[model samples]
Target: MEQPVHHFSELFEQLGLPSDAASIERFISRNSPLPPNMSLSEAPCWNEGQAELLREAVQEDADWAEVVDHLDASMHKQQ
Candidate 1:
């Protein structure tokens, strides 16, 4: 019983964000270089609901976790 894999666009959609490639890239560029001390869920960019969803995805290691981790890394990358 393998868990379903999720993509970045799907995760963005789940979070009620723009899921298109260009929009996703713009979002990452705008909000990226996340401070080394900060977690994705702790970023000021997220609302309460979005934060909770991010927290759960990581904590529970859900199908969304991989993409979430990818997002975390992407945000942390220096522009």
Candidate 2:
């Protein structure tokens, strides 16, 4: 398996996200799925709520709500 190269702290530092790296990492790790479909695509106009949805959907283990949420949020943010 291809492992993530950096630690969560390093990743957060690079991105300058407001959320704590440990919390984010814990959330991600707990929610992780197999057959990895995880990918995040950003939009310039994306709102925080929308971005959150997109982030959730990209996780390999996301539920149906996450998928629909991402779609709805992305559309709302764009419009």
Compare the candidates by lDDT and give the number of the best one: 1
Where in model 2 is the C-alpha error above 4 Å? 1-41, 65-79
Question: Model 1, residue 63: what's the lDDT?
Answer: 86
Candidate 1 global CA lDDT score = 0.95
Local lDDT at 67 for model 2: 41
lDDT of 2 by residue, 1-79 (tens): 6434443344334334434756654534443332223334354434576456546645654443444344334333322
Candidate 1 structure, TM-score to reference = 0.97
- What's the CA RMSD for each of the models? 0.6, 12.5
Compose the digit string of candidate 1's lDDT tens values, residues 1-79: 9899898999999999999999999999999899999999998889999999999999998889999999999999999
Candidate 2 lDDT score relative to the true structure: 0.43
In Å, residue 27's CA in model 2 sits off its true spot by 30
